[model samples]
Target chain A: MLLEIKNLQASVEGKQILHGINLTINEGEIHAIMGPNGSGKSTLSQVLAGRDTYEVNAGEVNFLGKDLLDMEPEERACAGLFMAFQYPVEIPGVNSTYFLKAAYNEMRKSRGLPEVDAMDFLTLVKEKMKIMELDQSLLNRAVNQGFSGGEKKKNEIFQMAVLEPKLAILDETDSGLDIDALKNVSEGVNKLKSKENGFLLITHYQRLLDYIVPDFVHVLYKGKIVRSGTKELALELEERGYDWIIQEASEKSVVA
Target chain B: MMSTTLPTESKEMHPYTERFNQLEASEWALDPSWLNQLRRAGIAHFAEKGIPSIREEEYRFTNLKPIENQTFDFCCGAPVADPGVSQVQGFCFDQLDAYRVVLVNGQFSKDLSDLSGLPEGCIVESLNEAVRNREDLVQGRLGTQVKVDQSSLAALNTAFFGDGLFIHVKKNLILEKPIQIIQLTANGDEGSNPVASHPRLLAIAESGASFSLVERCVGDRDTAYWVNSVSEFFVAPNASVEHLKVQEESLQAYHTAAIQAYLEQDARFTSHSMAVGAGISRNDIHSILDGKNSEAVLNGLYLGQKNQLVDHHTLMDHKQPNCNSHEYYHGILTDDSRGVFNGKIYVHQIAQKTDAIQNSRNLVLSDRATVNSKPQLEIFADDVRCTHGATIGQLDEDSVFYLRARGINEARARRMLIHAFASDVVDRIPYQAVKDYLENILADRFDPKD
Candidate 1:
């Protein structure tokens, strides 16, 4: 298994967000997690990325056969865990090329690889820019500063393409993208997908899954995964909506 | 407004009065009569005003009681051996191709200076030499630009200054290489009292002339020394001058400096003041737009760590019509250090169409670090545009997380953000070598420990 979480319970600021959650992902598999607003979808992604604010009350997260909960956020990235944020931050006065090069070189250094010089780094970044259809000028400008919403999302995918993590957790990457941007972003993700890596896509709508198909789907309701099924489960949720799942979870709790 | 009060009888004038009375006419190489007269006037002014107090509005944040209470021995002669020019090779902008002037213990060293191949009609000589040979040039512009009565420190420097430089850029001439002045303070033999030096510099850029000047102050090690320096610039019509002052004195030193410039019609002045040293330091810069269509740009950056205290005071006066002025200063403090930035822009009643902007931003890294920033603008003309603002803040947690999420460690991420914040002022520098040197220094000083 690329990632395994057993009985994960986490809270932020005195409020519990994830309660008794269990999930597993194998290599080359893409799992789509569909949920309504505030159903702990984004929280799960954040917890797996090792955000400090979210306190893990009781949980076990193993990545590549090692304990992932004990490591720092940067260590997790170096160990091949990538997270595409819902709202990418704007870092003024730091150019995109410099930031990306530093990130890539740091990861390489952690893995005992020879660092790439400025010339070679520039050439490599240019080749990756074509995949995201990003303008070459963006590399010279400040990181994500004054970028359109669609452009910011595209930049996130562009960064993921360059980093190439083993397990990628994308949090609501399709929230604000237009139709064309959605198609382009999906195509970029599809190109980077391979049999050696796994993906866990947390999204609210089923529109993103239509472009990049998922092998399995899960319904998350009230801080826990209520049900699990195949790809058809996403379509069912899209058509009938999340009221049924939420109602079923409430009734089950009442009966208990 | 000039007060004729004799400071000899004042209670605050005792220490300085005794020191002034001990000076002899034969001690200096300049014209004895004129020099004595100027020194007497300066001492009287200093005694009348005494030291600046925190109760005063202009000096509310900076307290100079420590310097005022301690009696420092004046370094009349070279007491320490010349450590040679190679001693300062590790300092900033040392490798740049320029006319180099070296000063050790407030005395000019000809062996360490390289003044060959200087352009014709340009003069780069010691102030002592200029005072003896070119008396007319030094007499008219020496103590005319700055008001000694307003600043007791400047008055004190004028009274007891031992040595410095005199630079003259002739009409319509442009210097291909920049002029660099390096000041090194060496400690006295094993166990002695703290020494003090007062160095004065004067530079005149004639009409249509242009040049760049870099002045650096560095010490061998952490020593208890006091340096009170002052520089005056006289820029003629259509002249352009870029002046950069880098102060990296010893951590145990007390440094205070002032730069006063007067601009003629259509003249331009740009200055960058970077202070990253001393236990306590203060830099005061005053620029006067005395003629029409002149411009001035002032940029400053200061970094303090441990118990260091850095203070900066600046004034931009728009006295004529159709002039522009802009000032930006940034400070970063860590540990128990404190920083102060006070900048003001004044527009005269006849100075219509004046454009002025002043901004002061500070970043405090530790809970104990503190910063006091005040930006003021007084505009008398109705057609002028003026704005001033100040901001004191800390590093953003979100920005730090953004870098850490990209695989950079927490320490490196914090360093990068701080560098980015400080780079805004450094990026405005037009000299490549100076910019690169400053960036390297910033990295070495602020880099995270392993």
Candidate 2:
């Protein structure tokens, strides 16, 4: 397995968010996490990325044979874990392309590899930007400083493309995206996927999953994975809505 | 009466002892009757004030121990050695090829200076020469505008200053090339006393005339030095002047500089001061809107490292109606260094429709670094728009992590972000050459190991 999370429990600022999350994804598998608002979807991705704001109270996250909980956020990224944030940060006065290149070289250095020089890095980003169909000006602007919601989302995906990871986590990447943006970002993620990498797509609506089909679908409710199923389960949930799932889970718990 | 009752001897004088005495009793004192009177009064003022201590409000942020302990002799009046002026690489300035004046050790050097391509009616010369040759002009405008009582540093400058640059732009004249004043202080011997140099400036922009002045202060390394300087700028009706003060004083020196600018009716003045210097330094600036419909802009940046202490005090006085001023200063303090910023805006009762904004932001790179920022407004006018804010904090951890995640090491990431933070303020400076030079010096101060 590339990533294994067993009985995960986490909290932020003393309030519990993730209660119990048990899941495993093999190297070439893509899992989609669908849930309602405030269902700990973002908290999961943040915890996996080692964001300091959230504390993993009780859990074991193993990635590539190393305990993920002990590493820093940057170390997690260097260990081939990537997270596309829901609200990307804007760092004024730092060019977007330069920031991306620095991030990439930092990850490379952690992996004991030589850094790419300016000419080489520019050529790499130029090609990636073309694939994403992003404007050339996007690379020159201060990182996400004046970008629109859709543009910021696309930039996040562009960054993900630049920093290829083994287990990529897309946390509501389609939240602010329009039809065209959603399609471009989904295509970019798909193109970046390969046999050596896996993905965790977290979303609210079922719209994003229509483009990036998942091998396994999990329904999260109140910080716990209430149900797990195949791709067909996503269709059933989309057709029946989350109300029925909530009712069924409550009824089953009462019976037990 | 005061001179007769005074004590005969004072505590051991600072090194350039004889030069200081000669500067005190020069023949120029007898040449100009008005200057003689002003000198005596200024000396009395300085004697009363002396060097300020921490108890004084203006000197609260900076300690004067280093300056008080160092006894500096006036540098030997040798000519400036051949230190070639090279164009700052990677920046282009087609407009900087104009009139220029160079100063070494508070005195003008005509050999190393150039003022050939200047427009008509533009007079740029030494202050002493101008005082003797153009007595009517010098005597009429010398110390009447910038009040000496407003600044102790200004008062001290008036008391002991010997020579400095004097510039005048006649009515309706537009100077194409900026009149550049570069002050160079060479190193003294290893065991010799430190040198104390004071360079003064008097700039006047006549009615409807527009021009720019750029000043550069540089000192040699390894030897301790002291540079106490003051500049007085006058902008006449409907005229505009842009003054830029660039200080890259040696990291081992102590510097004190003051800039006072006065604007008349419909005048526009934009001033910028970039300080990346000193073991201990203080910059005092005051801009008075003496005219209706005048506007002023003040922008500053100071980067301090190790044990350096940098203090900046600014005041904007809105004496008339419909005047606007914008002030912004940023400090990047690292390695136990300290930064202080105190800015005040005073709007008088007659000064309605005043719009002023002030902001001071600091980035503390080390845990031991410190910053004290305060903004004060005393407005008697009801119809005024003034806002002030200050912020001091460390570099954002998320931003650092974001950069590191991509592949940069922790140190490189921190340095790049700091460079970005400081470059934001540097970009506003109009002179490309000075901006580039500041960047080079800042980069060196940022990472000495690298």
Candidate 3:
């Protein structure tokens, strides 16, 4: 298993957001988590990424046969756990190329490999920029500063391409993208997917899944996964709103 | 303003006053008749004002006890065999084809300076030479801009200033390259007593002339010295001047400098000052828009760590109508350091249609670090627009996590954000060499081990 979360329970500021979340993923598998607003979709992603604000009350997250919760955010990233933020930060004065090179060199240093030279690194960045259809001028500008919503999302995927990870979790990557941007982002993700890597895509709408099909889809309601099914489950949920699943979960809780 | 009489008793006299009285009779006081008169007037003014104490409103946040308690011998005619020219060559703008003036230990080094291809009718020489040759220019504008009665330090500097740069750009002449003035201070001997140097600079740009000036101050890191510098600029009508001042003295040094500019009608002036060194430093800048439709912009950035204390005080006086002024200053404090910023914009009653804005931003990187920011605007004109604001904050947690999730360590992420905060002021600089030099210094400071 690439990632295994058993009975995950987390909270923020003393309010429990994730009561219990249990999920599993294997190599080369693309798992889509579809949920309505305030269904703990983002909470799950933040908890897995080791965000300090969210406290993991009780649960064990194992990644590649090691405890994922025991490592820092950067350590988790170096250990092949990458997370794409919903709203990418705008860091002024930090050039895009410089930041990426530093991150890439750090990862290489951790893996006991020699550092990449500036010329080689530039070539690699240029090649990856083509995959995301990013402007070459963006390399000279500050990181995400003055970039449009669609460009910001594309930049996230571009970063994922640069730093190849074993398990990647993208939280609401399709929130603010246009149709063309959505297609471009989906295409970038599809090209990076391989048998050696896995993806856990947390999104709200089913439109994104149409471009990049998922092997399995799960319905998250009120901090718990109410039901799990195959790819068809996403289409069913898209056609009929999430009221039915939410109503069923409450009724089941009363009966129990 | 309150006026207090000076004590007559010798014991009650300020230490600096006593030092000035003794130094006034020395042979170094020999100069032209007008220069001697200027020095005498400076000493008399300093004697009455003495050293400014925290009791005064202008010196409320800064204490001069450290400077008041100790006595620093003046360095005069000190022969420096080698002023570490090669070491400073790396810090200079050698890539740019420009005339260079190098001053070591408050004395000009003609051998190290390169003034070969200066423009015709332009004067680039030492202040001592200017006092002898161009007496009319030196006597007309040397002590007119700064008020010696208000600042005791300025008075002291006027009385004891030995040698500095004298730059004059003739009327209707535009220079192709910027002029770079580099000042390097070092102890006369290893492990010697503390020394001090007061360098005075006077730059004049005639009407219809344009030029750029870059002044840098650097010192030996291991020495304990005091550098009290005063600079005055005279911008004639319709002339434009861009000034860049970078102060990177020793960590154990005491630096108190002031720059005052007088702008005539339709003149344009912009200054960028960056302070990154000294244990305790204060920079005072005052710009007076005495001409109609003149514009002035002041930008500054200061970075402090450990026990360093950095203070910046600026004043923009709109004395004429249809003038505009903008000021932006930022500071980053870490460890137990403290930062202070106080900016004021004053518009007179006759100065109608004046537009002015002042903003100060500070980022505190440690729990113990502190910053005090105050932006004041006083407008007596009914048809003026004046706004001022200040903000003190820490690095945005969201920004930090964003970088961390991208595989950057905590320390590096914090440094990147701090650099971003400082770059806002640095980006306004037009000179490529100055920009590159500041960026490298910021990088080295953030990642010291590297």
Candidate 4:
């Protein structure tokens, strides 16, 4: 197994969000998690990404034989963990290239290697931009400032290319994209996927799963996973909706 | 105004008050008629306004008792020589080609100054000569541009100003080199209260003219003194002016300055005020847009260390249509120091289509360090856009740890982040020498253990 979570529980501000979650993933696998609003999909990603606001009640996450929960957000990035945010932050007056250089340098420092300078970093970023089909001028402008929704999503993919993480988490990356943008974003993600890396794609709609097809599908109702199956399960759920799973989970708790 | 009314300190009634009051203006009666009236009016206004109280809306952050307690005698004899030009000197400009004016103790020094590179039609003289020879230029513009009633310090400056620089650039003229003014305050005898001096500066740029002015103040490192300075800047239509004021006085000194500016149609004014020294310092800066299509950019940085107290108060008034203004200020405080920043931008009903933005950021290095900031915007015009923000916080711990985990020591990491925090304001300054000097000073002041 490449990524494993056992009895994962978490809370934010004295309110429980995630309860007793269990999942496992292998190399080169794409896992899609579908849930309704406030069903704790974003919270799971944030907790796994090591954001300081969430408190883990009971959980153990082992990634590539290391304790992933014991690191900072930036440290998690350097340790081959990436999270594409739902709402990206804009750092005004900070050049996009400068921010990327600093983030990349931090990653390199964690791996015990010398960092790249300005000239070399620019040369490298230009090649990565071509892969994402992003405008070159975006590197000189402020980070995530005045950028369209699609452009911001593509920039997140470009950052993933620069950092080269082992586990990439996509949190609602398709919410704001048009058809053309969705296709381009999918192309970028397809090019980045390899046997050495795995993906945890979280979305509310099954429409995004059409382009980035997942090998495993899980239904998250309320907090815990109610059902798990192959890709065909997503098509069935799209045809039938989530009323059956939520009803079944409610009945199971009553019987217990 | 005296609600708290603590018993007055004995130092407030020092002996020099009687002597200063006795030496009336015998020399003013021999001067021009208009100048005498202006002086008398200024004195009358000062008497009415008295001193500023801490409860006043405009001066809520700046106290004036320290300024009113000291007595400033009029140094009216022949110009004093530049004292210790070689000691405590800054970046030597010996090889640079420019016009330089030196002032010692609020008096213009002729023997130790040089003004050889300016154009033919430009005028650079002392305040006395400017009033005597160019009465039209001096009387037509001085004190008419600023709102003196809003600030008691400006009123006092108008009343007590003795000697300073008078610069005028003719129409359609472009100065190839900058004009530098050096104001120096030297140490006096022991056991005496810190002497006070008031220096005045007036600069007028004609239509289609452009120039730069650098005003710097320095003094002995361990002496106690007070420097009250007032400068007026007037930019005519289609003109541009860049003004830079640097205050690096001794730790035992008290410094205060008030800068008033007026901009006409299609005029541009860019100014930066950097204060890095003095035991107690206060700066009052104001700019007014009096014509259409005018723009102003104001930036400032104040670094306070130890037990020092520094206050910066600014006001930008939009009185006409189609005008824009931008202000950015940042402060770094360490130890038990205190820093205050109060910026206000007002848009009148007639000032339509106005756009203004103001922001102040503070970096507190210690638990005991404190900063008080208030960024306000009052707009009466319905068709205008205005926004203001004030942020008070310390360095991001994650960013610091990220840098430290990258082989940078904790000290160097803090320094790098502080420099990054201040770089936005520093990059807006136009002069290279002034920017470099300020960057060096900030780096030294923000060191981890400083």
**How well does candidate 4 score on lDDT at residue B378?**
85
DockQ scores of the candidates: 0.70, 0.49, 0.74, 0.10
- Per-residue alpha-carbon lDDT of model 3 for B1-450, expressed as tens digits? 122343445246565555665665665556687776777777778887776899998888888788777677776544564766577676587466667888876677787787898979788888978888999898878888875674888888887777778889999888878888788887766556677887888989999888888888888885678888888999999988888889888888888988888999999889888988988899998889999999999999998888888989998999999999999999989898989898988999999999998989999988999998988788899999888889999999898898888889988898888878888999999887778888888888786584
Question: Weakest 10 consecutive residues, lDDT, candidate 1 chain A?
Answer: A129-138
**Per-residue lDDT over B1-450 for candidate 2, one digit per residue giving the tens place of the 0 to 100 score:** 355455674444333333445665654535587876665565556556667788888788788877777666654233434445542111123346546677777777676677787767999998878878988778867766554675555666666667788889999998877877778776555677677777778888999999998877777764678888888888999999998877777888988988888999999998888877788889888899999999999998988888889888998999999999999899999888999999989999999999999989999878998999999899999999999999999888888766665546577777788888887888888777666776776778775484
**Candidate 4: regions farther than 4 A off:** B1-50, B68-116, B128-136, B139-152, B182-184, B189-192, B217-224, B248-253, B264-266, B275-280, B288-295, B300-425, B432-450
Report the lDDT of model 4 for residue B157.
Answer: 58
* Predicted candidate 1 versus true structure: per-residue lDDT over B1-450, tens digit per residue: 123265634334366667766664446534557866777788889877887888888778788888877767777544456786567556537458888888776667778888899989999888878877888888878888875775898888888876678889999999988888888777677677677887788899999998888888887577788888888999999998889988999998889998988999999999999998988999989899998999999999999899999999999999999999989899999999999998988999999999998889899989999998987778899999888878899998878877888898889888888888888898987777888888887888789656
Fraction of the true interface contacts (Cα pairs closer than 8 Å across chains) found in each model:
0.60, 0.48, 0.83, 0.02
Model 3 compared with the native: what TM-score?
0.91
> TM-score (0 to 1) for chain A, all models?
0.98, 0.97, 0.98, 0.97
Report residue B122 deviation for candidate 4 (angstroms).
2.6
Q: Assess every candidate by TM-score.
A: 0.93, 0.87, 0.91, 0.83
Each candidate: how many clashes?
0, 9, 0, 0
The second chain of candidate 1 has a TM-score of 0.94
Per-residue lDDT over A94-175 for candidate 3, one digit per residue giving the tens place of the 0 to 100 score? 8999998988888898899999999999999988977788987887899999999998889989999999999999899999
Error of 3 at B163 (Å): 3.4
lDDT of 4 by residue, B1-450 (tens): 363355644335333323323323554557766655655565556666666777777666666676567654445333443465454245234443456777777667665567876688788888878878888898878777543564555665565566677889998788878777777876455664566677888899999888888777887787778887788889899888888777888887888788878889888888888878888888878888888888888888888889778888888899999998988899989888889998889899999999898989998988998998998778899999888888889987655543433234467556777877777888887667767777778767766554
Q: How much lDDT does each candidate structure score?
A: 0.86, 0.82, 0.86, 0.78
